[model samples]
Target: MKEYKLSGWPELPASYQRTAYQRMLHQMSQGFVPLGQLLRVSGLGRDAVRRFLAYLQASGVLVEREHAQTPRTLLVMDWIRRTLGGTGPRRQA
Candidate 1:
């Protein structure tokens, strides 16, 4: 199975309202997601999930992964650093 990651946050048309599919896409935007997980989370069947993913791919909202780090991973790393008091780099006043 080809892995997919969000190229960026998807921008919906003004007419679009929050839906299960949109929620699925939002979860996906946080990280790379698998088809089965997406289907389960969206509460949609296989066919519907496939169709939506295809549409997102065609519209450039989703892109094929190429050794990309997921946003979730980055968030966790940041949390770890804070917990450890790493505090990144210090700024001179």
Candidate 2:
């Protein structure tokens, strides 16, 4: 299975209105994520997340682990985890 991470936030097109995509954007923004976990975390089903992943890849924000050459990014991700207390997916009332 391939793993991926965001190089940076991708700009959403005007047509993107799915809340699932929004949730996914937040999750992917966190750190490196494997495709399986991305689907699991988003709770938005496999097909939808896969499509979104493709879009992000095309938009150049999605970086495959093979291309993620920065160790500093890992360090920053760790800092974010510690500081944010693992703020994973959630829902609001």
Please, what is the whole-model Cα lDDT of each candidate in the order they appear?
0.73, 0.75
lDDT of 2 at 92: 55
CA error at residue 78 for candidate 2, angstroms: 27
Q: After the best TM-score superposition of candidate 2, give how far the Cα of residue 55 lies from its true spot, in angstroms.
A: 0.6
- Please give each candidate's TM-score: 0.58, 0.59
Please state every model's RMSD to the true fold in angstroms.
Answer: 9.9, 12.3
Q: Give the least accurate 10-residue stretch of model 1, judged by summed lDDT.
A: 9-18
Residue range 1-93, candidate 1, lDDT tens digits = 555668876666543344777778777878877776787787878987787777787778897654445699788778788669978754469
Candidate with the greatest TM-score versus the true structure:
2
Model 2 clash tally?
0
